[model samples]
Target: MEKKPAGSSLSKALTMLNHVCTSPVPLRFAELVDLSELPKATAHRQLNTLLEHGLVRFDEHKQAYYPGYGLLALAHRTWANLDIRDVAAAPMRDLWSSTQETIHLAVLDDAEVIYIDKLESPKSLRLYSAVGKKGPVYCTGVGKAILAYLPEAKQQDIIHQQNFIRHTEHTLTTPQALEGNLQQIKDTGISLDLEEHEIGIKCVAAPIFNARHQVVAAISVTAPAFRTDDASYETMKGLVKSAADDISKRLGACD
Candidate 1:
């Protein structure tokens, strides 16, 4: 076999790691050599480096290579910091500017949504919400947006956890009710909080996806219900969804 020259050490390492991480099943040594297109000696050396660094593990029984806990640790750190806030910065600003409404970036934590980033409205009247505050997944726009896109089993788990506290008259206080609403949001790729989380507040939200097309976060544009009429909500919906899509793309989501 004509051996292809391995690129820079970093590139070679990344190429091997990517394959290991992306493979649905463990890869044998021969399979990796063929997949990476590196000479056997080169591949062996690179595999040794990866193993030493805890990037991959070799199964002695199966004679295959698989991702290691090191990758999981790194992923935990990345998710803990949640670079989505930085990726959504510009788009969130644009959405806020377009709607002149309060903007929120939230990620699902267990059954609740944690407000990780917030852009206050330029207007005098803004809803009461702050970064690090937790909100219910069943009643808040950002929360519902994320919950709606989650896997069915996860959605059920979170839904089961909700206390169904009615914050306002509009709040859905039953699992059946919330489930129907989530189904609508899942179909539309949008969510709305019609004074469900807080009285006199309303918002439009959309889910943000990661590279694997999983819903990792959400964004919302909120305003006083008195000022947000049907027509205004229509406009805000488009802006919020567009901004979420932009942020998701920045995060490497294909759709």
Candidate 2:
């Protein structure tokens, strides 16, 4: 039997890693084989390589594979290196004080939205998500807002790379529908969560541009459903947009 090419083996390993990272829970070898579309022997070899590299680990009790400490270490380093968190701090605080809602700053990473900063509202009933949490780009307001302004090729690449898993009944699961929504967000300069990612959380988000006028991040205000009636939603939308615009301007985005 001929040995597979190095590129082919590397591709299989990456596919397996991607499968483990995307899943909400650990995956069994069978699951990895099905998702990666690789032969059982190939999958085992790739998984073993990943395990040796500390990119994957197996749970003995459950007999499932999960992302290993290597990924978490890399993620931590990446987050620390990004200056967006420092740049967003003052504005996030202002937004939090003004809207009295949870404020979040998120950036697009590997086709997902990763929260880098957050300011919790003082109110007892506020929505509570944390920094470093990852959310689907098609469902969360911050994700959609940034995605709306991304380059067409990058957007299409992300759409093609991942399966649109519906987190809730309201989640947009089809590529066409997501594209339509992105168009609307680009036109309006605002995006809405609408309880798509979480049942009771509603968020209004807008894009944050950089010195080159390219959108590099998004800022959002999230509140519970009970506090976000039609009128309040509109108010929060305007506030979130204004805050995002101010931050963009601070970063030298104009027009």
Candidate 3:
């Protein structure tokens, strides 16, 4: 490796991180020393600094260093500030006005769907869902919408993680049942939560795709089943799908 020129402290740390990431396997301290072209003492010192900050972790078993959970937290914080949320805001408001129902924007976290934003319903009926709260992906409209579009392996992994402790009588408590629902969502570009997560509560949801056509988040309109029969549910489905499409487009989604 060529000698790296002198640079800012932050720059050097980033370079070290990049070096470790480029390796196909976790790197030993000596390997990192060679790959970063830094003196052994300097490499050791810098790696310690990174370790303290949780940017890197040393595995006692493997005797190697790898990325740490702190970086994952930082990435999540960055995702929170992404322009996609801002882009979806106006569209969410417009959809709420048109439907006169509570709306939500959510992102998938591991095995749950985390509500990132919500616009409450104007009618007297209130729901328990609130921003930052998490619910199962196997039982909620927004949850299933995003789950259906996830890469197959990741989807299955999340399904495995689910406890399947039923929240309602209608909840899909088994993998086989949930798989069928997800397949329907993929085919229709819409997902329905038919009083599955909350009794007498239902929602219509659609997946939001990013520029690469990857499902990143979901939008949903939720209301009581008593207020919306199947006919009204169909109308809500169109509105929700349209709103989702608009947000996806603004996020640079092509299709």
Candidate 4:
């Protein structure tokens, strides 16, 4: 039997943590072993270390390991420190005030759209999603808009890695289908979520670019299906696009 160096063991543990961070649910020990290609005993030892350090936690009932509360604390720290939030706050407020629809600001994390900020609509019949909620990059408007503008290799990598889980009848579950939709979004510079991720919610989204002309985030206006008729969709589409453009310009994205 051969023993790995301390540095190698630490690297493997970090690799396992990175894999779990992107997953939607906790993973079993066997799953981690297979994914990380580590010996079962080594994986177990690493898991125990992570658990003790509050970097990972075990679910007794589910028999799976997931990221611990410490990871969430770290995520909060990162979010609070990022300059994008400061750059986006004023524009986001303006978008919310003008549309009166639920406006969301999301960034890409592990190929998924992670909502960092949200402004709920004041209307009685408005659609709402939480700030910390994560959704597939293929079916959601914000996700698609950002993904469409990403580098081709990165987009392919994400499509290949993620399961593309179908949440509703309208969800695009296949890579080819999603690719086609992304192409359409790239062509039109707009994205739509027509009851794709959620059955009764629709969204209009546009990409926010950074100083390097890279799509760094997305802005969206979500509304209930009943209020998302053709005319309203068109109107909101233009509005969201304008807001995204404003944010991008502020971020120094130019022609």
Candidate 5:
């Protein structure tokens, strides 16, 4: 019969929501309680509040909780507010239509890259990245494209913070190795994924400059290795760079 402040209650609810969203799989009520470390009654009450608002949903068959459609609406609104995404939409569509490959638009955030827009290919196999998901800059094409244009100090800071966990044999696991690749990307104004993020998935990417002539975002074209090879990547590199240039011009960047 004790009263808690409104702020405390809101924090508890938000914490529980994040726990459910970040879990690798749908989480049971007891699992959420354990992860959130909140009292049983308090955890249940907060979960009910979120579920009622549709921020979270319960799976009856699996008896677990996952992020709901409500989050999708919020995500849509969030991306809609980004001018870069709006500006890049047309060029992204054009590039996707031309190549029939997946297209991704991302921006550097802290030491990682956050996917803001994604156009899925008709192919059966696809990249695991999704809008709102965060990926390592050292391993992803978009990440490397942005990193190549970042100031040296900023690049070093990001590289130093990375855990360098290898996702594939092709992944660059050391700052020295990644730096070499970054230099190459800077020289050519293009970057390659080379199955570094996931096996069978490869991409070519280029950075989009803002009105201030600073790298603000990156665009990439991704395909399965089964359908593409070294020569295809070289072709993709040109396409991606051209699309990026188009987006950059729309953003008011000068030659």
Candidate 6:
């Protein structure tokens, strides 16, 4: 075996790790060697380096390599320091421009959604939701958007935490009703407030996913119910979903 420069070896190892992580299933050493297109000995050497550093782990029972907990810890650190508002700014502006509706970006906190960013519409009538304000996950578009995509266990936990306050006549006031609405949102990939959070205010929203395809946030386009006719509502739904998709892609979400 010939010695490779440290930089070259490190690059190859990182590239191999990318392949491993992107794979839909755990890979055996032989599969990784073929997938990486690296010399068998070089691949072996890189795998050992990755395992030694805790970046990768070999599953003894399955005889395959999987992402290690060390990588998960690193991912958690990366997400903790990430600013979702920064990732969503461009798309939010574009959505506001297209729909002439207020744009909001929010993330789940406990059982609620906290507004992290807001772009006001140019129109005289716009949603007055302030950044940093929190709203119930069961009644708001952005909140439901995030809640709908959560795992069933987590979703139930959050649902139980809701006070089930009837902020408006349209609000889903029961766990069963909210769960049904969430199922529809998850199926259609969109959520509608329909004046549920506040009288006269309505919105369309979509979930934003991270690299792991987990729902990390949501984006919305809000307007007064009077102006959100069926046609405009349909348009805003697409715009909000598209904006969410763009932001999700920026955060490294895959199809």
List per-prediction Cα lDDT, in the order shown: 0.90, 0.86, 0.89, 0.85, 0.91, 0.88
Tens digit per residue, CA lDDT, model 6, 78-189 = 8778788888888988888898778889999888889999888788764547899988899999999999999999999999998899987898999999999988998999
- Alpha-carbon RMSD to native, per candidate: 5.1, 18.5, 10.3, 17.0, 17.8, 4.4
lDDT of 1 by residue, 52-127 (tens): 9898999999999999888877866765576777889999999988988899999999889999999988788756
Candidate 5 TM-score, C-alpha based: 0.67
Q: Which is superior by TM-score, 2 or 5? A: 5
TM-score of each: 0.70, 0.66, 0.68, 0.66, 0.67, 0.73
Candidate 1: give the clashing pairs: none
- Estimate, for each residue in 1-255, the C-alpha lDDT of model 2 and write its tens digit: 433434567787998899998999889999888878787888898999999988899999999998999876776676447587777778888888888888889999898889988888888754436788887898899999999998999999987765788888999999999999999999999999998988988989999997667889999998889888899888888888888988887776777
Model 4 TM-score (2 dp): 0.66
Clashes counted in candidate 5 amount to: 0
Mark the regions of model 4 whose C-alpha exceeds 4 Å error after superposition: 1-82, 125-128
Query: What lDDT does model 4 reach?
Result: 0.85
In terms of lDDT, model 1 sits at 0.90
- Ten contiguous residues with the weakest lDDT in model 5: 1-10
Q: Positional deviation of 46 in candidate 4, in angstroms?
A: 60
Tens-digit lDDT string for candidate 5 (213-235): 88999999999988897687778
Candidate 6: stretches off by over 4 Å: 1-77, 126-128
Model 3 poorest 10 in a row by lDDT: 1-10
Cα lDDT for residue 224, model 2? 89
| Residue range 1-255, candidate 4, lDDT tens digits | 533444577898898887777788789988888888787788888888888888888899999988888886775676446587677788889888877889899999997889998888898754446788887888899999999998999989988877888889999999999999999999989999988988899999999997668899999999888878889889888889998998888776785
lDDT of 3 by residue, 31-138 (tens): 897777776777787888899999999999999999878987886676557776688999999999998999999999878999999999898667868999998889
Off by over 4 Å in 3: 1-81
